[model samples]
Target: MDFSDLGKLKDLMGNAKLMQEQMEHRLSETVVEATSGGGIVTVRMNGRKEVLRLRISPTAMGSTGSDLELLEDLITAAVNEAGRRADEAMKSSMQGMMGGLDLPGLT
Candidate 1:
């Protein structure tokens, strides 16, 4: 309401914007890899939970129905693991950045 409070709010908004930009940069830079079925399926994902790369070993591929089902499951598991790791990485990177901001509804 007061001029001083308004000025402080402006500064807080600026800081929040800067932090969001930094987090976006970090997200693009952060890469997480995960494997399933003893590395038969490998997944590389970014902090945004986007899959960057996927690799399935030759031995893991087959023509049979059961083999295909197993492969699908393995891929699913690997992608999920990669996404989980990405979330962890983002949290770890942003840990100390939000310490004192205390932005209402954001913290």
Candidate 2:
């Protein structure tokens, strides 16, 4: 509409962009660790939902070949748990950063 309104809009967009950058940095820095199957399988994931590391205990390989299926299930469980944690952590972080600022098309 008016030039002053346009300037305010520009500022809002700039601030939003800055917040987006900061959130991305925070997400990259955030990490969560989880384990499953009595800690036989462990996974570390970031807020971006990327698995940074995975560990499997030697005990997962039982004497019987049937143990392989159990190991797979354990790994899946561990990864899913880590992903759930990352989602929660990121959501909390975003809420704090956003400070209830529900901008149009941003929420």
Candidate 3:
């Protein structure tokens, strides 16, 4: 609209970009690990939705002649647990960034 309004909009956009960049940086620095199947499998993920590491316990692999389906299930369960932890980590980071404002659907 007016010059002042245009300036305000530009400032708002810049602030939003800065905030997003800070959030992304913080998220990248956050890491979370989750395990399942009695800690037989572990997964590490960063807040940026990146998988950093995966670990399988010896006991989990010691199942010789075991059902293939069972192993698959265990792996799936472990990965799902890791994903859950990742989501929680993301929420926590966002909450802190937003000053405890849990904005619905922002994620």
Candidate 4:
């Protein structure tokens, strides 16, 4: 390859690295919230799919006479929804960074 082509390749690699770093920073800063059971259970997650916070309404935790299984279900639903939101956020961020370029294995 010519020296000019080599220089261009290097520049391309540097740009790619910069974009990756930017995406990582953006993912860390991005946050999403999800709720289940009519907001009885809520979850907040980052674009990395890490749960940052979880909240359960006092009413969601039923009295001693209430059903424990229902509470568990609500929590599970909230967490799953949070994860889905995180995934969507990441996907959207990636698309923006890539400028809609269809990269294999990226989606």
lDDT of 3 by residue, 61-102 (tens): 654667456667777777777778878878777777778666
TM-score of 1: 0.90
Off by over 4 Å in 1: 100-107
Name every residue pair that clashes in candidate 4.
Answer: none
Clashing pairs in 2: none
Candidate 2 Cα outliers beyond 4 Å, as residue runs: 102-107
Q: State which candidate has the highest TM-score.
A: 2
Error of 2 at 6 (Å): 0.6
lDDT of 2 by residue, 1-107 (tens): 99999999999999989988999998899999999988999999999999999999887778876798888889999999999999889888887888997756544
Give lDDT for model 2: 0.91
The order by descending lDDT is: 1, 2, 4, 3
lDDT of 4: 0.88
Top-scoring candidate (lDDT): 1
Clash list (residue pairs), candidate 1: none
Provide the lowest-lDDT 10-residue window in model 2: 98-107
Question: What digit string (tens of lDDT, one per residue) describes model 4 on residues 3-96?
Answer: 9999999999999999999988988999999998899889998888888999988887666644578878888998898888888888888888
* CA lDDT, candidate 2, residue 88: 87
